[model samples]
Target chain A: MSSSANEAAARASAVSEMGRTIPTDAEVPHPEGVRWGMVVDLDRCTGCQACVVACQAENNIALNEEQRVLERRAKTWIRIERYWEGEFPNAKARFIPVLCQHCGNAPCETVCPVWATYHNNEGLNVQVYNRCIGTRFCANGCPYSVRYFNFWNPEWPEPMNNQLNPDVTVRTKGIIEKCTFCVQRINRVQVTAKTEGREIRSGEVQPACAQSCPTSALVFCDINDPESAPAQLAEAEAGRSYTLLEHFGTDPGIIYLKKVDPHAEIHEDEHAHAGAHA
Target chain B: MQEPVVADTKTSNRELLDFVFAWPAWFFAVGGALNGLLVAAFVVVILMLMFGLQFLGYSHPVYWGFLIVNFVFWIGVSHAGIMVSAILRLTQAEWRRPVTRAAEVLTIFSLLTAVQFPLIHSGRPWRTMYWTFPYDWNRGAWPNPRSPLVWDPSAIFTYLTSTILFVYVALLPDLALARDRAPNPVSRAIYGVLAMGFRGTTRQWRIQTVAGLLLSAIILPIFVSVHSIVSWDFAVTSVPGWHNTIFAPYFVIGAVHSGVSAVVTVMIVMRYAFGLKRFITRDHIDSLARLLIVVATVWLFFFLLDFFFGLYGTEPAEVDTWQRRLVEPPWVVIAITFIICAYIIPVPMWMFRAIRRNFFWMFVTTILVNVGMWLERYMVVVPALERKSGLTFTYGDYAPSLSEFILVAASFALVILGFLTFSKLLPIMPAADIKEGQILADRIRVGRANVPAAMRE
Candidate 1:
């Protein structure tokens, strides 16, 4: 070949090789036989807001005061949704922790004008905080009111402010925010695994609520990885496990174990927790 | 500075133009302030309660009344502006020209205000982005497209862009006029930059008119769609009153009803404030009242249609919603009055030439229409959920908390503030369009098949 042609060939090969190389920066290295998810066993959950507080503490969600809650301005990244089933005497309150069900087919992702929210490799729903223009489109679109907006500049008293997670941004007024299933923690686990040159292990990188659950009601694991506990539990509890607002065609990431009605057969006129069978 | 495209045909010009445009700001400022104070008080109370609840928090319903009401109210208020602007422009309503800017401006600003509730509604407005898929690190995560919240940005964004483009395109010739007519250098420069080098030549007029028409055509469906989508934020849910199929059109007409009324109110203020007896004449007011009356009737029709559909099926929850609105133990009569005030009262009052001619009655009807619309929106939303699952949370009443009310007040105040600032800069009327309109009126009188050449210049 002519000298110039040879040079062109070498340049082309270098470019192609660069293109083929793996991106070291933007990857979530999957754990060996693991996928990330939450499986709440409704039978065990008593609707006590322990998981909500635990998640809030771990994630540094803002404290929603009465006015905020009254204004429905209270932001609970993780909330225990109670559904009434049956009538008064037989009413059963079915309690479930509803959060960003990091859906496999999340509804919030598609409508982002700036593409701020997207799905991660590990089946996680992610929000790029900086890219989001506080339009609140995603919040309105969600079937579940899981998404929250920061209406004003956030406030914290002296010294109490020190508790904010450096990993998460303290959102300003006008932008939307919600649960990431503790993605910062997930990123940390992946980074640790990366430097060690090993894949993530099962039971590693558990979200704060799942990690702190006293009843072990909230389970996290890779549903894709059949060997993972969440996966196994999901399969074992096939009849009981469900996702919130399943009819909306938003295949949510979080799986909920149906609030068990030990009294389903007996409970009648007194059903307080009605599963949104409505 | 706006250019003089069309000559003023009226015997009197400046006195009329100046006055019609003045009062909305003053009235809005004071009205906005009083309303703002009320809303402010509401906000403070909510904050006190939310914060105060930590010590002895009640646990019956975590997410309760005020938040839900605010969402519904603000969203409802947001509907009127864009829909009225876009639909009128698309349908070729010249009467819209004087009022469209205010209406469209109302839409964009109101949207800014309404969407705030969700975030502030969250006790913690911080860390709201967890709903979006991925952060800037490009971890390949993004929001799911199927969700309404996701869809919401697209809808609102499209609406905002269209509204802005419509506002800008319509304002271009006026801006050029402002530039030409500027009494000072600063005004000239400001108008020059804003006008984007517009000159009222034939080609520029043709191009702008075409663009304006196209933008209006595009925005019409978009304005309608935005409200429909907003309705879906509720309708898509399995909730009884929310999930009804009639929500889309119902919302559209309701928006029109509210928006048209708002336009009337603003116009009346403009008439008295700016002394615009000629530019915004009795014909314009008559035209406006006629349109608003139709909108009121349609709002009533859709509302009744939805009511009947619910009553026919007799679904207990839907029935309960109707009953709570119309026949419940509470002041159902008051609810009926609200509807009548919004729909029933406005039409008859507007129909009579006496009422249409009388500025006082005109002003009264305008205020009544908006009040009625707000009440209708409340009836549609709060009552549906307040008594979910066959149980009424009667004690759990909704009054806007202090902060939210303040913010709501601030939103109106800001709109007026923004308007006052905008008026100080831009021409209150489309000087070019009105001048051209005068030329057109003269041409038709002269038996010319074509527009007068001077007007084109």
Candidate 2:
């Protein structure tokens, strides 16, 4: 081969090696199988709302003032949705903590005009705040109704301003906001593990919601890791575990265990835990 | 041999030219007031953007409210220009001469108005420019092609550019006549430049005619694709009511129905405004009304097809949406009004020859049809999102706020302001085409009857 031709071949190889460093879908099958997931135990949840408070503090979500709530414009990244079961005299209230599901086949990611939201290799649905033009198509496409829009600029009065989490951005008006499973904490843990020259252990990353759950109802871990709590619980509780809106084929990462009640009737008219979804 | 038809067409040419040359004071007074109102509303909208969008009344499930509905409505209204001008011209309809210019102007102005909704509706209206443009050399980012919203800018920009060129190309001959008859040097200079040095030579006319025909042919498919893409904006989404397969044809047919009706309303008003009753005869109004009846029927057919698909489909979400829309309180009333105004009443009223010929009744019926079509857009956009499926707990209602109402009023004012300004600057009657039509439309006597025949040559 000529000298110039040999030089071109060497340059091409170097460029291809550099391309490998920036992860492509083919390069990153997540060889470690590090797919993050969550499991919510409906049987154990008492609807105390400690997780909601924790999420707000960790994510720097806007305040849900009384007037904003009255106007039905309140922004909440995670909230408890309550549905009543039967007749008023014998009614039972069910509470489900609804947040972004981070679906495997996310509808919100496809409809976004500017690609404001996308799915990452770790099975995480990431929202690029700067890219969003606030078309609100993503919010409408979300069947879970978990995405919230910042209708007004976030206000942090006096001393409460100091409580703001520097890790997460304080979104302004006209943008959609949603839960990220405490991605800041995830990044921090990954950074520490990398610096220490070690792989991240199972249960090492705890989202604020999971950590604050008083009854230990919420658990977050890498489903790809065989030793992870979420993976084992998802496998062991297969009979009782099912996803919300499985019929939609969203394939969400979050799974829920059915509430256990011996007195619950199985009949045509009355579904035992249908109220939880409703 | 000189055709007798030429003599008759000349009688109104002077009057037609005079109508545009003389700018009426009352028209300016009215147009200036509308322009002032539009400027005020725009200022308010910008101020609201800075403070927050809460004033628009958009909430969780009902995120797209009046802004989107107004967008679709104005775009549908813009469709009339293509139907009346290009479609009628290609078919060689003689009566199209007096009405085509007004309708084309409507299309241009309304489309300009419609493009604003997406910009203003953006949460970050300022950043929308960067978001839509496909250059990310610095950021290493590009707009997602998979998105229908990305497709919207390309389609609307193409439609706007082509329609503007179509209007200017067709206006050249008339502009030449204006340049020749200008009483002042300033008017002569302005009209001369616009005329682009046309010498009225046979070769120039031949080239213009071929270019016009070619442009009309190309614009036809783009017109169809533009609205179909707009419908896909909703249909591509998984929202229960919007995710139907029938949205494309339904929106297209509905656009024609509203567009043809809007042309009739404009023609009748122009007849009085320009005193061109002899030019835009009662025959022209009747033909447009007849065309409207056919469009309305086809629209009703598509509406029924969509209704049945939603009603009988086994999908629980689709069925629930249809049932709730009908049985629900305010929506039930809106549905009833949409039927009466869009189809039931206007269709029957347009059927009668006497009603179609009468200017007042024609005006009232066309206005009713537009009102009904606007409601149809509202019904399609708002209700689907209001009752979006999956989480029944989050389903809610939408009510347009005072600011939204102001924005709607401003959009209408902008359309009128644009049309009035164009009329003063150019001859809107298509005098040259009308003379051509008159020459071809000589009377023919067949046995016992005297009938008008337009010789194709």
Candidate 3:
């Protein structure tokens, strides 16, 4: 039997498990040739912090007030990770937009005692908050400081509450949280695509940070599609592509374009001048 | 042992004994209250500063100062308590029978005290759990687990659960003893609930003992890790003075020092208070105080080693950090005095039998040692932030706000209230463990006497 036949049988078992919800026309396309990926160009990143606000606004993140920041207890799902480079006179600082790498070999997924998080087929790491018992084992397990906890019951006084997303669940006081790849939006797009009977378009659902980048530094798309712009850009340059802490074997869905060095000194070879100098 | 008999007599002996022994409780209560008041007063002043009524508070050079100091200090205090309880059990120290309950209780209370420092250190206690899991269930809106702050709480919660279990499981047989041994029906009922229907069969004792030993094994590493991780909160950061290889062991040793000193302090009070001269003997104090001084030396040694190594590295950040640490005014002087008092001076005096044996000196020494340890934490926490980084860049200065102080006070109050409430429900000592110790002592005595003159011939 073909792999599709095997899938049909598996779906039949799943339907049995679910007690048959409606008539089972369970033939769904195997999201063929779609490996989700991101390309982040640091050279173009101005550290203007627009992506930070856009991500927060779209994600409905809490605004940790003065006191929270003062305590070093502020929570942010995504932020423009700022770091200094060089020293003194020639010192130039660099800013990178850091988020979940959505690693294929995600460290967070394996450590969740409750299976509160797992990697889906779409190369997106997902967190199921209601199922989370709030152990925070995943947080400790992750090298990247991307995972954040709901240390307290979030309060969005008055009108602030109105801005909350209806598609997402308002997490209670005790759970772990992190970048979900905008799972709510993905689910919406997925349902819409299914309703229209088509595969999800390559550039259809860009993550908020990627969409908000004015300089087009951040590009989120399917790397499996060779035609995708991010994949194209990645293939176009050797000076561009690298993953953070790649030696750790996390196979990050997020890719960073190395900061360009315009002033790299060129040295002349001795052989060229050997006619006289040698 | 029975209190109702006192109704016929001029006074009940147990009641009088309790009244006398309860003095430590009084002092701790009064002392905590006073400390609490001081914290509140400072907080109010800070609030005033925040409103611009005062000239200064926390500033850009050090965003977290005294509050961080207090947090670390209290966490240091918590360390020694659980360590004493777990180590005593691990070593099967029979003398631990009488004091284990008190120290374990101290662990829970001190941890409670320490956990609050961070919360109130924020000066906004209400939204503190915002670090845990916030209300936003969606991705990109959660707390960062990759942070030391996140790890600190997870580790702390682990410690809390294990410590609570440690104390509660140990309390079972004692609770049963209190239940059977209570003077009134009311006391019995309360003790009964706390005891969880413990009947001291050999099976029950075996199960409980094995469970406790396993927990201690698990808890000991966690206990080590909890403080190490707490130290990591500093060490992991890029701050110069805060990051050091010595911090892990040094903090551990300091925790043991403070914790052991606290145990001794409590024992001394209880010995006098409940007239428990037969229960907690001179040997216990002698061994513990001696052990603590040695522990303090180890702590000091680690500090020195770390300091010199940090200097040898000749890294600018480290050099600047140490310079600021050693040279800073008022705080530095106080800090030096604390280390000397806590570690160096205590060593020689503790070697003397009279000093270790004497209750007054022991109490004074323990208190001083703890104060010094607290200051040590203060040195670790505040000084690094006091100066600019190695790059000549400044962080921020912190003077704890009014809310911070009150909430800190409330935490101490909570500890006292939890301890007091717990003490009311159960005997702080394990009755079975004491019984077992008495049996072991009897067996040892018999074995010693059994080496007959005939056998020698």
Best by DockQ: 2
Model 1 segments more than 4 A misplaced: A1-119, A123-265, A268-278, B1-10, B13-248, B304-338, B377-399, B416-457
Per-model DockQ? 0.08, 0.53, 0.04
For model 2, give the interface RMSD. Answer: 2.9
Candidate 3 chain B least-lDDT 10 residues: B1-10
Docking class of 3: incorrect
- Sort the predicted structures by DockQ, highest score first: 2, 1, 3
For residues B1-457, write the lDDT of model 3, one tens digit per residue: 1001102111222432253224455657655676666566566645533432222244333445555666676677777666777887788775666778778888888887777656544423344454554333332234455456667788888898998998888878767766766767986788788888888888988889899999888898888888888887767554567657778887887788888898888888767755567667677788788778678878878888878987998766567667766875656696688878787777788989989888888888898887787667767776676553422322334566555556555555666656655564456555566655544443223554742222211
Model 2 over residues B1-457: C-alpha lDDT tens digits?
1123533745656877866688788897988889888987887688778876878878878899888989988889889999888998898776787888899999999999999988898888887765567655344456777788888889888999999999888889999988988889999999999999987899999988888888888899988988899999899888888988999989988888888888888888888887776777678788888888888999999999999888776676777678667778888998899889998888898889999889999999999999999989988988888888857778878889888888898998998888877887898878777777776767888999977666565
RMSD per model, one decimal: 9.0, 4.4, 10.1
Q: Over all chains combined, what TM-score does candidate 2 have? A: 0.93
Q: Worst lDDT window (10 residues) for model 3 chain A?
A: A269-278
After superposition, the stretches of candidate 3 with alpha carbons farther than 4 Å from their true spots are A1-34, A46-53, A61-95, A105-118, A127-179, A195-197, A224-227, A245-250, A266-278, B1-256, B275-283, B297-345, B368-408, B418-457
DockQ of 1: 0.08
Pick the winner on TM-score between candidates 1 and 3. 1
Give model 2's docking category. medium
Q: TM per model?
A: 0.64, 0.93, 0.60
